[model samples]
Target: MKALAHLNKYLLKYKWYLVLGTVFTIISNLFGILPAQIVRQSLDLVKDTLDVYFAFQGSSLQSGIRDQFYTTIPYFGFLILLMAIMKGVFLFMVRQTIIVMSRHIEFDLKNEIYAKYQELPMRFFKQHNTGDLMARISEDVGKVRMYVGPALMYGINLVVLIVLVISYMLSVSPKLTFYVLLPLPFLSVAIYYVNSVIMKRSEQIQAQLSTLSTDAQETFSGIRVIKTFVQESFFADKFRAGADEFKKRSLKLVKVDSLFYPLVMVLVGLSNVLVIYVGGQEIINGRLTAGNIAEFIIYLNMMTWPVMAIGWTTSQVQRAAASQQRINEFLNEKTEIVSRKKLMTEVKGKLSFRDVRFVYPDSGIVGLDRFNLEVAAGESVAILGTTGSGKSTLANLIVRMYDPEGEIRVDDVPLKDYEVSYIRRQIGYVPQEVFLFSDTIENNVRFGAGELTMEEVEQAVKDADLYDNIQGFPEGFQTRLGERGITLSGGQKQRLSIARAIVRQPKILVLDDSLSAVDTHTENVILNNLSRIMKDKTSVIISHRVSSAKLADKIVVLDEGKIVESGTHESLMNKGGVYFELHEKQLKTEELS
Candidate 1:
């Protein structure tokens, strides 16, 4: 029950509807008991009238008794019919008000979870799988709704019905009421035991389902690799194993759940039998009338549903608690990335890294050790580094993807002091690994820039040297792309990513080895176009080839997460250091090719 406390705000938001629903529930059940009493009284009235008729047979009183029976019987029957009709109407209102409100709350909860996902840091995602998160959003959320809806409704109904029905029974005969309630305590004990077992089984079932979802999602995403490696049988067996485990856990849950209804029904049956036996003896002793016995039995039957509902409602409560705990765990997570500072104006692209240090969270391996760099506004600086030389790590720092030990600044404002959104908005980043959405080329290029014009998109496409290739396609910009733009070649994908970045017209551009797939001729053409576009903006280029770095105003070389050289290309070539060796090797490799 404590697991559901977080939903209190939503519950309060729709308090009026729930209140109205509760009122209707009470009214419906109140009328629900009247029909049984009516039947009992009508039966007694008929039994006495028949006696009077027999006593007065062939006498003047016989006609009068028959007349009385004809008038009274129709009136009693109409009263019963009226109560039933009213009960049905109020019951409908109860369902409409409370049950419908739960659906509305479910909608709000789904949206809130999605917003939280957007707000969380990248590190949170790295620690959680996509499939498990998806299951949380879908399966776990539905389970929580069950707690709010049917479980709440039935639980409340049981309480109200029990109180009213028991009071009436006690009024008729206290001794009979006591005997009828003998089995209730036992029923409660059973419910408690079943609740614990169901909760544990529910957790296992949810976990297995998450594993299955993850397996299926991963297989679909890596279908190409699976086919290439001929590992279909391997994945199929893995899926079958997951399915079997899921089934076994579910069956265990079903076996436990299957006990609840029978246990409740058996207890109710015994109570009913005890009522008949005890009440008949009381009637023979002249302590109670037959009409009183009939009325007591009617009230006892009324209590049956509430008692049976105990077990089923307990199952719902336990299942909901387990799901709520899972959901609350995620909602309570502390987000590492948040924007609390306010920037007065749009940021300038003067970037600097001062003694910055960083380590990957999982491996505890240093990604950057006391790294330092400065790039003034409106300058192009190229970084040349080996595979593990921290080039991309530096680019990620500028975008505030991760926090490091020392200060990073833009326009003299510390990165943390400036608004995170403002900083990211001012930079256009093209990472080495490109990811394109499954959409038309035009929409992909203008994804984040919702208000971009066709002319602006065309200009960006031309600048990235992708316009000519796109023009050759039948649909041109409207051509739809496959997942991750699989329909395009490697070079085309890189250029499309570049076009996406340029369309934003950001203050700073970071191309982290974004052109590795292009040939030298095409790379030169794209670089020439970029030189013009980058004239009045700061640009950082990460590249391995000297040809790509030669056009920059200055070049910096990184080795093992530290700067080894920094100078103009010609000056570095003349110095015969690390940069000189890389340039010479690249020249020889090109000559041989």
Candidate 2:
């Protein structure tokens, strides 16, 4: 019930529309009640084959005034037509207003959800499935719209219709109305029990849908890998298992849905039987007119939907409740990293770590233990490490990706004091994994770094050694890239990613195994081009190949999360430490080949 309260926040802008639609519904119900009056009067006007008596006074069931009785026939006829017309108009107004409100609300929610996604940290996406997010923003929001629009409008009609019909019923015979309406208390209890069960099942069904979506999205995007490994049949079996599980849950829900409406129909049927039985005996005893019985039967039939609405509206309300809870869970999530300090601007590249230590959250021992490092502004440094060394983790600390236990600072300011966005703005990162968009080469190069002149764009392309390859295409830089840049070779995609980072023109550039995919000749060419253009920019390059590390002023060797060796190439070679050993091993391997 508390979850439904959230709709009030998102729907604040539409309060006027809800009010107007409600007013229309109330006015429309008044018209619906008039038809009963018309029929009662019309029955009284015509002659009756049998006479009937009443203990208390009541009107004719005929549609208009009597031929020779109470009032003018023409006036009653005009009254009947006017009531019917007004009912139609007001019903239209209510529907039109609610429908417009639904579209407006849907559009705004979609935009707001998308904007929230953009602000969320990268780690948030790594923990959640992309498909589950799509279902929440797209499918679950759709479920809420059904309740807010049609179900909400009809719910209003149901209440007003029941009030009007029951008022007339009580006026005619209070004792009978009490008896006829008595079953409702039990029916409401039954519906509430059913609704609780459905809400739980609805939540499970939505979760299963997210699993299915993630499987489909991953399988489709990596279909080529499945083919390359010749594991298509294995993937197909896994997909089939996921689909089968989804089907089993769906069938269980369908059974619940199937039982609901018919159970409601049976309840309505029982109420109808009581009305007919009591009204018929009254007619036989001459206590009720034939027209009065006829009007009551018609009015009772009209009341069926309002009675059904009690059940129908509750089911959708349960669905809306479930959807709201899921959306709230996502919106309420607080990332492990946040900026509680004032923003910092103009970061200089003097970074220091003093007595720093870190362990993975909610888990085991330190990734780095009491590690310390310092570098001067505009310094070019290279880190060489064997597998399992903490090279990348060290780089991550500089940008505040993980919270360390002790002090880490940039330009004498503790890193925590600087805002994450402002720090990241001055730093550019190119990860080991190269991800590219499915768009033109130009867009991939620009990639959200906006409004670059062609000259500025060409400079990054030249620096990454990709300008010649792109110009060779018939479309030049405008050639369309497939999903994940499928049309380009792996080396080309990596270079394109590098070109994108270079375009940002940051003060500190971090390249994590960036040129590993390129040939030795291409790598040499790319490195030479960078040396010319990157004379002013500071860089930290991670490479296992000493050939790539030889140009740096100093090289740091890492092993088992600690610095094992540090010096210039000639000094490290003269010292015969780990770096010189790795360099000699690679040189001998190359000579033997």
Per-residue C-alpha lDDT of model 2 across residues 1-593, encoded as one tens digit per residue: 68768678656789888889988988898888877878787777544411322221265633232333444566777888999999999999998888778777777767777777766655567668899999889878887887788778878788777888889877876755775786788778887788878888888888888888888888898899889999888988988998898898878877876776677678767777877788777778877766677677777778777777766677677777888788877777766656768568686677677877776554554567677777666776788887657777667776667777888887778887888778877777777778888898988888757789888788888888899999999998889988888889889988888888888887777777788899888889888876764566667777777877876767888887778888888999999989989999988986887
Worst 10 residues of 1 by lDDT: 336-345
Q: Residue by residue across 1-593, what tens digits does model 1's lDDT show?
A: 89889889999999987899889989999999888788878888988899889998999989999998999999999998999999999989988988888898889999989988888877788888988999888898899888788888888788888888888888778999999999989988887878889999999999888899999999998999999999999999999999999999999999998897898788888988988899899989988777777887777777778777777788888888888788888899988666657664676688888999988786687878898888899888999998989888888888888888998888888888777776787889998999999999999999787698899999999999999999999999999999989989999999999999989988999999999999988999999999998988899999887888987889999988899999998899889999999988988998898
State every prediction's TM-score relative to the real structure. Answer: 0.95, 0.89
Q: Where does candidate 2 stray beyond 4 Å? A: 47-85, 282-288, 362-366, 589-593
Which regions of candidate 1 deviate over 4 angstroms?
Answer: 591-593
Assess each prediction's global lDDT (C-alpha) against the native. 0.88, 0.78
Give the winner by TM-score.
1
Candidate 2 has its poorest 10 consecutive residues by lDDT at 48-57
Please give the RMSD to the true structure for each candidate, in Å: 2.0, 4.5
